[model samples]
Target: DVKVTQSSRYLVKRTGEKVFLECVQDMDHENMFWYRQDPGLGLRLIYFSYDVKMKEKGDIPEGYSVSREKKERFSLILESASTNQTSMYLCASSLLGLWATEQYFGPGTRLTVT
Candidate 1:
């Protein structure tokens, strides 16, 4: 089955610490993305990779970046976690960013930086 799994369901960290969230997909999708989801704010892209070792900053890339070392794995890293940065992190994957492509999302990771 095609699925994506996140490394954590919830996270709590002190302010100013580095944080890492991992994601993995099993469908060999070529596109992977990291997004932040907040109530009534919708999903905002953090970063994405179209292929292994190919990364691009998305709309909301500040303080966050991504790594795609393998076709099926993508990782989101917060350079330094902050209270204002606390939000739900979602990982997603798509076969390709074609006209009819649909992204599949992971369960999500709720992060709290205090």
Candidate 2:
């Protein structure tokens, strides 16, 4: 079965530390996305990559960056973590063609910055 997995389910970091969140999909999807879920903000996209080594900034890409070295892997990097960035980070993957509407979401990584 195809699955999307995150490197960590829970993470805690200092206010100024750098954080790396990794996501991998076994489905060979061409599109991968990073989103953060906050209480009132719902799901805000941080970054998305359509193909390997190609990334695009999403709705909320201020403090975050993304890397896509391989087709099945996508990484989200927080240069300097802050308390305000603390939230549940979600990763999703979908096909790029007509079925692009369907996305498979990872379990999520809840990051806490103290």
Candidate 3:
């Protein structure tokens, strides 16, 4: 079975502290994505990598960055945590080159920056 695992299910941090969220997929997928979900804005893509070491900035990348060192692992870094950045962060992985391929999502990490 294909599985995606997240390092944390919840996180609490003070403003200005750096945070790291990790994800790993058991499936050998080529596309990995990081997204943040807000109440009004919905799910907004933060970053993605189609291949190892090749990352693309997404819609909201101002305070976020991503690293994909291996095919199955992707990491999201919050440069400096802030109250506005508090949201549920989701990580997903999908197979490449398939029109209908569904992305396998990890249980989101709910981060609260006070």
Model 1 / residue 55 / CA error / Å: 0.9
Estimate, for each residue in 1-114, the C-alpha lDDT of model 2 and write its tens digit.
779999999999999899999999999999999999999889999999999999999999999988999999999999999999999999999999985698899999999999
- What's each prediction's TM-score? 0.96, 0.97, 0.96
Off by over 4 Å in 3: 98-100
Report the poorest 10 consecutive residues by lDDT, candidate 2.
95-104
lDDT of 1 by residue, 1-114 (tens): 779999999999999899999999999999999999999999999999999999999998988878888899999998889898899999999987567378999999999999
Error of 2 at 5 (Å): 0.2
Output the better candidate (1/2) by lDDT. Answer: 2
lDDT of each model, Cα atoms only?
A: 0.93, 0.96, 0.94
Q: Total clashes, candidate 3?
A: 0
| Ranked candidates (lDDT, high to low) | 2, 3, 1
Which candidate has the highest TM-score of all? 2
> What's every prediction's RMSD, in angstroms?
1.0, 0.8, 1.0
**Model 2 local distance difference test score:** 0.96
Q: In candidate 2, which residue pairs clash?
A: none
Q: State residue 113's C-alpha deviation in candidate 1, in Å.
A: 0.3
